[model samples]
Target chain A: MTTPLMIEARGVEKWYPNGFQALRGADLSVHQGEVVVIMGPSGSGKSTFIRTFNGLEDFQKGSIVVDGITLSDDVRQIDAIRREVGMVFQQFNLFPHLTVLENVALAPVLVRRRPKAEVQQQALELLDRVGIQHQAHKYPGQLSGGQQQRVAIARSLCMEPRIMLFDEPTSALDPEMVQEVLAVMQELARDGMTMVVVSHEVRFARQVASRVALMADGQVVEVAPPEQFFTAPGHERSRQFLSQIG
Target chain B: MSASPNLSHPQRTASPPRLHRLRRELFASPLDGLITIALVASLAAAATGFLHWATTQARWAVIQANSNLFAIGRYPIEQQWRLWLLVTLLAAATGLSWGLLRAWPRADRRGSAWPPNDTIAAALLTAISFYVPLALHAQAGIQMRWWAITALLLLVRAAAGRWGPLVPRQLRPLLALLWPVLYLIGMVLISGGLGLMPVPPAEWGGLLLTLVEASFAILLCFPLGVLLALGRRSALPLLRWGSVVYIEFIRGAPLITLLFLGQNILGFLLPGGLAPDRVWRAAWVLTFFAAAYVAEAVRSGLAALPPGQLEAARSLGLNLPQSLMHVVLPQALRVALPATVGQFITLLQDTTLLSLIGLLDLLGVARTVMANPAFLGRNAEVYLVLAILFWCCCAALGLGSRALEHRLNPNTVALNTSAHKA
Candidate 1:
């Protein structure tokens, strides 16, 4: 992987319309093909932090440069960044009206203006890779939570994105279904896709992530390689978060 | 047979026959027995009465062409066929198409909870009972166009089932756009423009003209309403305020007054010699008034969409127009379809108000029938027919919305049914 840094964020701050500061001076950087896991307690801005990478969440004062394009009020550039960075929601917002195959193929056909046959073929292949090819014709509502999450992953991947962000993709899954979704993510990570995952799945982070960053109080308290971050942490907040979630 | 599978097990006890179960259910309580008995007796009596009217006691209604005046005004007798055929075809085709789309399945037989079967049966019986009066009092002619339109509706329904296979998805927008375009062409040609086979605006009366005017109003109102909705939600203050004032003012007053204003007030706005035909003026006024109400309905749909949908589209690299067109409008229209149909029914009924401005719509023509010396007291009969026509149409539209809502809510049904069973 010879590509340079895919994302860089500095001094990112967001104050919601209701005066809640979701992200306060959050800073992060992601190099090409790097897997960064963001772990934190609930409402600690970890999900918001990852969402900013794809412009799903906007910040009040920050500079986010993704894939060499700057993020601002200019609609054009933000769209460009979003095309390169795909964010999967915790809710797995697949269109309920469409089949799993159509859901994956929709953005490719509509937004990317790809040929129908080519997109459909690629979507089928992605579904196969996610181990849900047989369920392609069925709707999301007809599938289990884990199966829907896998379809969501394949949908994001259909855009042929350079970076993927997962915001607790397994949080909504049944206990028995969690491993099925995590297995798909594990395969993607092994294939060298750059990923920023915000989850409490400590075992997934320990096995796959090159580096783990602990976020607390709308800020990244510490970032370290998996071996040290799990074994020893510098910040008291990181220690407390790990102790609670481990 | 194979050791009797434990007689104590509930499954081994033969299930009660369905008829016996029904008997128990219907006769288990005194209230149910009373209701069932009353219902059966009433139905029996009604059926006997209807049979007598249709078969034994009634004369066939036939319009007498020899003595009856053709077209009611200066219309050529040859051209009268076109209008009469157009009318019967429109009515019967509408009724038949409505029945095809929404007729319930055979097994349900729950006696239509919404429009009770009794209301339908009573209406049919009454129509049959009035055969003698109708047969003696009316006149008609041959109907080539009537058969043609009936055939066309059959073709449309037969083809609609194969719509997915026959129609390309991309062509759907054009298919939707067709009705309004054709309506515009019809209005222009019938209302006399382009110097090609012009039908004079004053001569436009009867059911054909009523349909033409009402459909034209609907066609014009939809786009105008959509534009108004967009304007009301626009960022610019001038456009927003203008839309609000337009919507509120038109909705505040009765449509009859608007027609009056169009007839009387607009003469002041235009130069004396440049004023359009009064009929055209009334058409525009009706279209504008309807557009306001339709705009509010569409706005309600727009407001119901979740903000996440817009954000999701924005994040997907869709610009404002793309987002609105692909995401926002599709969802909004799905929600707004029933309301749009409701607005159309209102517009259809409102066409009668044009009679106040001297246009001879169906209601206006019915009133003319009442003025005839022989038919002086037949006002009840004419008005009854008119009421039935309007009621049938409005009821069909309301039922269509309910069917569409249910079709869109299948998942909710499964969830609800499971919850109920639990």
Candidate 2:
């Protein structure tokens, strides 16, 4: 079996308006159904790099392709790329104004213009799958952190995305809530969804990730399977990051 | 369940007698207590004097004689049905639409904390200024119009209860999407149209004129405000700068100055030989003024949102328009309600200034009411009635905003109910 590339981001460079270089020649490639964990200290451009995949963040110079389409300045192409990519934010930004079912159903009904009844039916099912069907009628504000994050995941999944990007999804969770979110991610990985996750959960990476890509100062410092990357790092930067976390 | 952030509020408890609590609160120290007693005595004396004068000396003849002018001000009596019908339709549509949308929105029901003390005091003072003389039943025609309004409100309540639940949740956004169209139809109905006689806006007067001007400006300016807010935050410098200039310029100038321009100067801008009607001019100015304010309110609401919301919407494949209409606007409006309501109430009061421009607004017509030979020297009574009218309208706005806020804040309602039960 041959692996197909799902994302190819090369020579990515980004600078803030104030001349702060957040990304300098960052590069990474993700294959279909592969779980890539990007582990980095804070401010290493982990979030920025993932954001560029869905056009949430723009790079000054880069050729980033996702799901066979290359990123461009064209609105249509950006929209096209977004349809195939689902992103879960650290803040679990489930729309507070909408109930869990509505939040999950919003994209499909509004963007896809699918019939509301069908999407909402599927939403409740998705909620059931995430073990939060009981909370489906409730608003995001009424839910606990773990439940909100789960609902956020269900909301993203309702769009039927081909690829998922998790920007430190569990970072904002309380200690007890972290595993509940990770368990959902693990189940998604087992279902063979192509995923790029920027997280510091070393144990999660070792348990489920196909590859571990360590980033520093907006560039990929090392990439290897979790076992080799964690136990036998080839780069000093990778070793230093691992040691700091350890 | 009591997750209220207000840790300062004591638990709801059975307190001591009201007089005892009042004494403790107002007169904690001996000197303070003495002063409080003296003030209470003087206030009671003044109240007794006021009650005597109000019950015996004050003549409500001015109110009784000019009730028609105060309510509609010579709106061709036959054509008055148009206003009544418009009122019913607008109320029904708003009630139905809002009820449908109430299925979502976790709004704060703990009451919208009014922003400043001055506004409350001012509103209360104006309300108090007129209610004493205004309560007397003056005319059957005015009472019937009011009855029709109450009937319309009850109809809305019944309709929303029966049909609102039947509207599919997915179709609710479609209702929102259709607002501009519904609003246009409602405007044409009131402003005259298709088969109806074209009642020149010039003929709209008194409290009817005031309410129409303020309500239309509010309804129309909201969409404009949303657009302006988006433009203010747009990536294009042209749009962003244009919005900034428009908002700042309109906000920087006083509302009356803008009204003056709308009344006199706007006619010059229109094509020669066909000056725009007075009502349209006033409305245009009021809409612009209110839009600028609504834009700023919406901007703050937009700003209060975390960047994650937009990002989340976009990442789900929802395009700019879809994201804005569904995700962004709903949340923004939730935060912006109080500010929007404040602008609306202020615009309502400012409409009285149209009287200064020779329009027969409530205040303007009240002056006409006083000029009548029988009502001469009854200036205090007429003005007091006018104040009561304006105050009632403003109070309705406050109550509506609170209801909308409560409907939106389901979590707060949940907490409130559960806490009470506990």
Q: Largest DockQ belongs to which candidate?
A: 2
Q: List the residue pairs that clash in candidate 1.
A: none
CAPRI grade of model 2: medium
TM-score of chain A of each: 0.97, 0.98
Instruction: Report the C-alpha lDDT of model 1 over B319-347, residue by residue, as the tens digit.
Output: 67877876688667667778888898999
- For model 1, residues A117-223, the per-residue Cα lDDT tens digits are 99999999999999999988776788999998998899889888899999998898889999999999999999999999998898999998988998988998898
Q: What's the alpha carbon RMSD for model 1?
A: 7.2
How well is each residue in B86-162 modelled by candidate 2, as lDDT tens digits? 66676667656544443333333322122243245435644543443346563556555555554555455445545
Q: Rate the local accuracy (lDDT) of all candidates.
A: 0.73, 0.82
TM-score of candidate 1 to 2 decimals: 0.78
Output the lDDT of residue A127, model 1. 96
